[model samples]
Target chain A: MLFDNTDFDYEISFLKIPGSDFNKEIRDSKFLSPEEGFLRGNLMKDEYVPYKNLTYFKLTPQNEQETLLLKLMAYSFTINDLNLYLDLNPKDQQTYELFKKYVKEKNRLEEMYSEKYGPMTITETQGSNYNWIMDPWPWDNTGGSMYV
Target chain B: MFKYVKHLNYPINIKKKDLKMAKYLLTQFGGANGELAASLRYFSQKFSMPDEKGKSLLNDIATEELGHCEMICTMVHQLTENATIEELKAAGLGSMYTEHGKGIYPSDSFGNPFTVTYFAVTGDVLADLSEDMAAEQKARATYENLINMTDDQDVIGILLFLRQREIVHFNRFKELYDYYKKKGY
Candidate 1:
């Protein structure tokens, strides 16, 4: 598969470092895997500060729908974190490239998820059926089946 | 313009309902240092940011805070949806029930309605960024307090995730603040 869960190795050498200072900064800012990032609510390892020695909860997906949805959440989180980083350090070409990679993967995952399940966004609804109003809205008790 | 995404940033499926926990969690939805205040604070402050970096960072973070608001509301809703009137009364939400009747309302643990006074937007960049950083800390503390009140692993997990977000956001705001300071903005 072009995009797999293990594709988080963003240490590609093709992306050049624009400057020494920024290069050092990038080297300093280590990243966590998408799954870890999603679980911890942070992409950067240095910035993830646990409160009072408490560990985050582990998510165990019960079925295929949840498994895919979890992947989408992780990728989306990575993309958002990269976006915030890029917003401040726009000149960091390497991180920008990594950001693009996550975005692409997340987009593909979202499409795949929508196709298999129902539309997550109104625009991504597949087929003629308007499944946007499908049951188990995120807030609904039965919605987050995997969460239990 | 914003498009709705049906999925939450994180999944929240609280299989066990706790009315007291729900009452406490509502503070994050409408408290002084809650998600609603955080979102509005950034939304209002972004306009006067010195550069595109500050503007975009504030804008994007504000957008994320809105999502957090939804998450908090969802949690409160799920936690209290199945509770009876007696359960609500015992949980100290009886007064709240008279007001909103199991519906999620923006108010603190004390049932004080959310007000614009909870946040402020000074046109000054440094002051605004400082406030933003402080806001994130306050929020992180609030999440910790909430986590301490609940023993549910499910609720704790979500609270922990949200708390971590505050740390990340604090770092981001501090970075921007430092950048602006270096540039003498």
Candidate 2:
């Protein structure tokens, strides 16, 4: 039912990503400025959870430049987590060191940005033995949920 | 040096009456595109497999299919429970219903019954992998068709889950095929 012919264009737009062939034109175009490149990369990477309400700025950037940095830090956190938890071996010690270094940087950025807006509570529930209040799972809401 | 070995067994069984659905399930189970034939093909092909990973992949997938056979039998039993002799005959299950009267048995959907000819044990790895891939697609499609026919939510859920598993298994075999091809075996 969701695939009815009339909404095909709208549905197709939802599937576009930088790496996908559908966005080839965007991929080939050069950035107009450093700020543009940074913002474009962040949007393409899609590494941050979008706020539920557009007007709610809690832990979210008010401008494009801050949004780019927030996304960059979030992306770095994901890469570090995967390297620590899933990778077969830590071939480069520097990568692990970099992850540790970035963790601090991310915390600082989160704190600074959140000062202007209310803090974002990423976790919802904590149990005595197990914590279940985590970000929504991948299948729950796709990119709308936390990146991790 | 001896390597550590772990033995695994499928944790299910088929009963006499369960054959009604099994027969239907196996109709495409052993011909050029059937699951039984496909599984046997992969199992035997292990001997000529040049790499440990390839051999392990084929053997594991073939072993899993045996469990799927058991699953189909389980579904058959659940579906045909408590049917009267007359009721079964009326449903066109007379050949099997006459003998077993809702007893589980393995046969094609038409009640031709199962035979050893339903499986093949070809030793060629390439031939066997090709057969396994095709077999998975066929089985997945059959599950989809069966889901559409049944109004039972439980049955539909099971079929959908099984269909998804088949897709996953197909992807794994595809990756294994690519790895083998790259290794030139």
Q: Give DockQ per model, in order.
A: 0.40, 0.02
Per-residue lDDT tens digits of candidate 1, residues A47-146?
A: 7677775767666677788778888888888888888989998999887877887788789989998998888889985858888888878778777433
lDDT of 1 by residue, B1-185 (tens): 78888888898888788998998899999999999999999999999998999999999999999999999999998898889999999989899999999889899999999999988888989999999999999999999999899889889889988999999999999999999999997
lDDT of 2 by residue, B37-99 (tens): 555666767677776666666666666555455455545654566566675666667777667
Which parts of model 2 have CA positions greater than 4 angstroms off? Answer: A1-148, B1-35, B116-119
The all-Cα superposition gives candidate 2 an RMSD in Å to the true structure of 15.7
Per model, how many backbone clashes are there?
0, 14
Off by more than 4 A, model 1: A1-29, A144-148
The numbered model that scores best in TM-score is: 1
lDDT of each: 0.84, 0.45
